[model samples]
Target: MAFDSSDLKPVGARPPLLDYLVSLWGARHFVIYDARVRLAVSQDHTVLGKVWLVLNPILFGFTFYLIFGLLLQTNRGIENFTGFIIIGFMMFFYTTRSFVAGARSIANGQNLIRGFSFPRAALPLAINVRQALSQLYVLAAMFALVLVVPPSERVGLHWLLVIPIFLLQTVFNWGLGMLFAPLVHKIPDVGNIMAVVTRLWMYSSGLFYEPSRFTDNATILALFHLNPLYQILQMTRGVMLYDTLPSMEQWSLLVVWAGGVWLLGLIAFWRNEESYANERR
Candidate 1:
């Protein structure tokens, strides 16, 4: 596992791993520049540019509203279906994009893989950072939308829970991305398969309907609570809708799951790091 100096094969003025890490840290400007350009390119070429950030979750919220709010009438007991859906969808999208987009990052960066010798992992990390920042735009729109359409209960101090929740979600996203990195790199079709899986995941995560609304059976309730996404969403709903903190059990589960997933993904991705630069799609 050691990078022996004698064993190294230099590429251009390629720095040592430690030096690369240090330089990468100092290259904050490069990271920011790359992030800004990618964000702009991804946004500008589209019809609405940055507004699409707002539009995506809004569109999803309205669609869920029609299905769960009206058709199924799943808004029972709890109030403010719109706020509920908005928070849930926006947060869930973070995980979904991480899963789908992160899955393809290596293959997508094929050119960089062939051309550059810096941390191959940075490419994926950069994508994750870019997407995370994009989520803030959606968060802002969520606040504005909720203000105009005011939820039944006031947004309380518990809304601040979003800070930690997002941090946990980001780590979880990184883990998911790393875990999938090699899979997509090898099979390619796994990326397409993940897209379908994530859609199914959204339906099951109570993005459209609250899991609690479905049933009271112990087995069914247990199943819903066990879903990590459900656990995270439950924590979010407790904060935003009820203005209450999650139970200690919920917080514990979030920490355990996020930590476990992240470690697993990091190890999985690192194991194959040496192959990434040479792999052909």
Candidate 2:
């Protein structure tokens, strides 16, 4: 009276990649529900509640405008510096927040990880989803600022491109979060260093000033061009502020970046799945 144990696997073992992906797909409903609940409660402790989502970006835009636009005169040649800075800060924060939150998701969710035997990637994925939901309010506030501020931009067909650009950026953000979650889970200190790194990234992405104004070096310029966030802000500005369509080249680069990072990050995160639950202890 022996049982066939060949098909039996240990609990908490990592599944095959394809099976892992399928399991994740099957858990989409849980992910969405978790994201929704997190988004709803994210600001509950504050008096301003969800208003902070919109107000935070508005404040960031104002601070940058004051420092760079009014004081430093970085807005010198740009026609609509107000709109440019708003788009840059609002859009860039979406990715930055996602990256930081995702990087810390594993460490913060140790309790849940210990309690459940689910795909480890779900924590970071849920963080990205919550950020995406929050970005909707940020986007509304951004559009309002660009429309009402002096030198207002007109709405055009090109503006519709924001939807796709945002979607691509979300995917990129998810990938970045997944890429760093494991590292942060292991070292913990990488999370501390990310603040400075992201600040440098913000500057390099040309959030407050035009990169071309300061650098004439072809290599530096090309590096900026290759930066996905740079391309995202550029394309967003092109459509939202300039009423121009992003070139095919810009679109291609973004697609490559988003897809490549997503694939790479998935592998990175999934490879260490079994270790996540154990390491957290």
Candidate 3:
């Protein structure tokens, strides 16, 4: 008796896009569990344990505040510059960590990729999820610092806006990770380049100084306005520090960026699915 072969596909063949998405959705439980497990053990061997998650960013923020706010006087005209820098550093680091980890996911997970037949995208998705989980503690530390630091900010209804802003930034970070995962996998050197790139991004993001202070050029200001990370930082500062709601323009721009990058990144990452398993072999 002959069996029908029409429905059969090669073992490693790439699935259609919709099927790929469904498969990824089906694996959501695995992704969440993997993220939780990794997050739990991430600092196991370190002396400080999970405290480092909150401490590390706090230390960085303090150092920057000392140098820029105190010594350099970049905080000259800005109100509550301490809180501004803290929020920028913590939030920006969240994306930086997520992007770098996602970029290295495929290269680092070669063992699992070769051993299993799961959706390749899961690797990066898991990495971003792990970062997002870790970020929660970091954010809590940030808020505490903002409220307790010398020049304290008051809690208000505007602070509620942080929830949506954070969710958008998280989605944007996932999209960014997906966007670069394939490139880094294909060219491992991209990982090194990303380090320098992220540094430049941090500087350009107005982490230590206000952009308006040094520039009046519409073109330059527009470029900053167009940056999604800049928008994220600004919107976060508006609600958390200034007790003001973000403008609708800021909201619209961020929504477009988060949605556009996620859609494009998904397609880009998915197109390279079949190559992932055999790329460097």
Q: State every prediction's TM-score relative to the real structure.
A: 0.88, 0.97, 0.97
Q: Which candidate achieves the best lDDT against the true structure?
A: 2
> Which portions of model 1 miss their true places by more than 4 Å?
1-5, 10-29
Lowest lDDT block of 10, candidate 2: 272-281
Task: Point out where model 3 deviates above 4 Å.
Answer: 279-281
User: Residue-pair clashes per candidate, as listed?
Assistant: 0, 0, 0
Candidate 2 lDDT over 1-281, as tens digits, reads: 99999999877788999999998888788889999999999899999999999998898789999999999999988869989999999999899999999989988999998897788888889899999999999999988888899898888777889999999999999999999988999899999999999999998998888889998999999999999999999999989998779999999999999999999899999998877876644
Q: What is every candidate's alpha-carbon RMSD to the true fold?
A: 4.0, 1.1, 1.1
Which has the better lDDT: candidate 1, or candidate 3?
A: 3
Candidate 1 residues 101-143, lDDT tens each?
A: 7778888888877786666557667777888888889878876
Clashing pairs in 1: none
Report, for every candidate in turn, its global Cα lDDT versus the true structure: 0.77, 0.91, 0.90
Which of candidates 1 and 2 reaches a greater TM-score? Answer: 2
After best superposition, candidate 2 residue 280: deviation in angstroms? 5.6
Per residue, candidate 3 scores C-alpha lDDT tens digits across 176-256 of 888898999999999999999999999888888999999899999899999999999999998998877899999999999
